[model samples]
Target chain A: MKAEDVIRFCGRSLAGYPLRTGLMLLAMAIGVAAVVLLTSLGEGARRYVAGKFTSLGTHLLIVLPGRSETVGGPPPLLGQTPRDLTVDDALALTRSSAVRRVAPLMLGSAPVSLESRSREAIIMGTTADMFEVRNLEMAQGRFLPPGEVGRAEAVCVLGQKLRNELFGNGSPLGAFVRIGQRRFRVIGVLTKKGESLGTDLGEVALIPVASASALFNRASLFRILVQAQSREAIPRAKKAILQIIQERHEGEEDVTVITQDALLATFDRIFKALTLAVGGIAAISLAVAGILIMNVMLIAVSQRTGEIGLLMAIGAPGKQIQRLFLSEAAMLSLVGAAVGLLLALAGHWVLARLFPEFPLSVPIWSPITAVGVALATGLIFGVLPARRASRLDPVVALSRR
Target chain B: MIRLESIERIFQVGDERVFALRQVDLAVRSGEYLSIMGPSGSGKSTMLNILGLLDRPDKGVYQLDGRDATHLTDRQQAEMRRHKIGFIFQFFHLIPRLTAAENVELPLTLAGVDPVARKECVAAALARLGLAERAKHRPDQLSGGQRQRVAIARATIMRPALVLADEPTGNLDRASGTEVIHTIESLNAEGMTVVMVTHDPELGRRARRQVRMLDGRIVSDSGAGHEG
Candidate 1:
């Protein structure tokens, strides 16, 4: 028979039972929609995390006094005792060709009082190069002046929020704010930079490393931040820093050096695997839908035995009979897949609107794979019923009716 | 022309093998109107089914138009049935989902005839059967006689050489049954060979040639000058 005629015949038979047809379509559609929605969520989470890591800075590496066993895991609280990294070590590291700049960091908390407005705020102490290495912007006067390493000049830069709390619409440049029994002159106010790597950048105080070390009564630095001259220099810079730090600490190799690319790559691989896992879980629904199609088609074949016998008697061969039934299944799955795509699109749109901060969008391959799988499932599940229909004895079928 | 030689059909009932047809030999000319008459279980319907290629006898050599058809493959047999034979059933067997016109057009469609020619032929067949007005109505919407007319139109739509009718008027009222019988008689008069199976003795006698069957064997043949 002509292809068009086959489709027309199947269409007539399917239309005879509206409820059954609608139910099959619904099952297939829900299966496809579930796969799409879940995969989108998985893909969105991956993108969101990737964006967060990239914002920290590129071609950057951190040198911590304690070693981190895993690349991305948090530093152990009480691991093997490691040698302290001094400001001298950080300054010496800049001598390497791969290292473009170095910013020594020391963190502590101190109470600040400016005319009875006292707040215990976090204090981040580093040199003027900290602004360039960390991508910080200045809102007011100049940052800490260029000076000798570890010079004890008491100078500070206020975070945007701290500046507002201290001076409230008034300029605080060159004003002295007492921090930990020492007076410090404010030289600059930082432009607002929201949370990054779990630190509220906009609410802290920036001071000289030497002053913070003295106030906290410590000689070793908290960590050292390094920036490579170019992206290609990151590996060399990491090697050079480790060698330099080991040499300075009596060949102890106590510090852990992690590159920004290494951290980002770890996160990328983890999220990619997570996306595939969720997509695989969602595919189980497609299999369930396939089983449903088979069950319903079996019932349809038995119910239409008389009609099938009539066709056989009129000279339609077994292959033609199989094609007719298979075409019906194909039609149902195609329609269901189209509707599922529309549902997924609408779901994505609503999710993007509701959670604007999250990067919510499906990969192009999600819909394509969904369509391919849906068609394959329909054809595969259709075989059993079509074969049974073809094998029925026309004489017996007609006689029974 | 058609020929059947020593045809034997057996049915398994419990542990007993019942012979539905035994050693039956018959030959029919190209344009003959013949009828087979018998009571229930006499195998008249079985004989009609075998002649139409709807069933195969266990031991028989059947020929149609001089072709050795007893060993034809399933597909070859289907092709032969499509081009050379048509069937009309006692129940009419019109697909209830289709309108009268679509039901009549089914055979041509299965033969892959072009839409334009198929439409014209279906229209002509329905008009000839006086079903032009009811062409768009489904089988359920038509009366018993109208449904039978539609079946006849479908059976002859392909212009097959032989038409088989098994109790074609069995389910109709007397007036509708007479109308159906007249329609088949007209087709037969147009030089179409028709083989009908019926239990009505009067209807069986209307054919020019009649064969009577009893318990799996032909007891009498009018063409051979013997009456049971």
Candidate 2:
């Protein structure tokens, strides 16, 4: 048969049973839409986390006290206590040529009261270099003054939310605020940064590292942030910090150094796998759709047995009959896939409008993969019914009606 | 021309083997009109199916146009049917979804005839069958006589050498039956070999040659001596 005639014949057959054809198309379309939307959600989450990491500043390394071993068991309750990472260790990291700057962190919660207004806020104690290392911006006044690392400067930078709570809309810079038992002047106010890593940057108060040690009455630092000279210097800077800490602690590698690339790479791998797994789960629906096509096609073969017999009597080969049915299936799948792609895109658009901050997008390969798998499913599942129709006994078929 | 020799067709019903057609020998020349008449289960339909190549005989050497047709492959048999044979059925087996013109164009379309030529042929055939105005009407919309005429148009659209009709007017009223009989008779008058199977003695007698079957055997043939 001519290709166009075959198509027209199949088209007429499908159009003859509108309800059955529409339901099958709906099933196939839902399967494809599910795959594309779920994968896009997974990819969106991956990009969101990656964006957060990029905002944590480039070529950075985090140094924390004690090794975090991932053994397949519960952590030891009475594990060996590692040496404390001090402000001296932070100063020692600055000597490496690969390291651009180091900011030692000391975290503690304290009540900050300005006159009668009081609220408990997290205190972040770091050096002046922290503003550059952590990508913090100043909304008013200047950041911590660049001076001696050990100087116990009685000055602080209030977070945007903290300043709002303490002084409302009024300027809080240069005002004295009592944190715990000591009074410090608010030297700067941070911009309206939201969340980073897990910390709400808009809710903390930044203070000098030495002043935090005196206020919290501890010599040990919480963690150290090191910035490498360039993207390629991150590994070298991590090694230098580890070696410096080990040497300072009398030949013991007590501190764990993690680079930004390593952390980002780990998250990247995790989310990619998650996307593929979700896409795989959605593919099961496509298989179900394929089975539906097979079932319906089988019914169609039986329902149109008389018509098939007529074709055979009029000189259609068995192969032509098979092609007719197979092309019907292929046409259904192709149009269904197209409709599904449109559905997914519309879903993405609606979701993006609802959550504008999220990086909502459909991955390029998802549509291609969905359509390809849909076509394959149609053909593969179509084989049985087509073969049955082709092998029908025309005489017996014609005698039925 | 068509020839059949020692044809045997068996059916397995429960534990017993039933003979549908036994030792059937028949020869038909080009452009001749003939009819086979029999009661229910007399193997007349079986003969038509075997002659139409819709069924295979258990033991026979069948030839059409001097070519061995009994053992031809399924594809080759379909090709032969495409170019050399036409069929009209009792219920006028027209696909309900297609229009009269499209249904008539089926054989030519399957033969890969170009759309323009196919359209012209279908239109001419429909016009010739007195269904020119009903060409765009579906089978369900056409009257019984009109539907049978559409089937006739379809059967002759391929310009086949032979036409086989198995009770073509079996389901129609008296007037429609007479109309359909006249249509096929006209095709036979135009030098196309026509073989029809029917239960109506009146219709069977209208053909120049008549064969009567009983219990899977041909009991009588008026044109027995005219075999090619």
Q: Which has the greatest TM-score?
A: 2
Candidate 1 local Cα displacement, residue B68, angstroms: 2.1
lDDT of 2 by residue, B1-228 (tens): 989999999999999999999999999999999999999999999999999999999998899899999999889999988889999999888999999999999999999999999999998998898899999999999999999999989988888999999999999999999999999999999989999999999999999999999989999999999667
Once fitted onto the true fold, the runs of candidate 2 whose alpha carbons sit more than 4 angstroms away are A70-80, A113-117, A139-141, A164-178, A181-188
List DockQ, one per candidate, in order.
0.66, 0.82
How do the candidates score on chain B by TM-score? Answer: 0.97, 0.98
Cα error of candidate 1 at position A124, Å: 3.4
lDDT score of residue B167 within candidate 1: 95
Best by lDDT: 2
After superposition, candidate 1 runs with Cα above 4 Å error = A70-80, A108-123, A135-195, A200-220, B224-228
In DockQ, how does model 1 score against the reference complex? Answer: 0.66
- lDDT score for residue B212 of model 1: 95
For each candidate, what is the lDDT?
0.87, 0.92
Across A217-255, the per-residue lDDT of candidate 2 in tens digits comes to 998989999999999988788888889999999986788
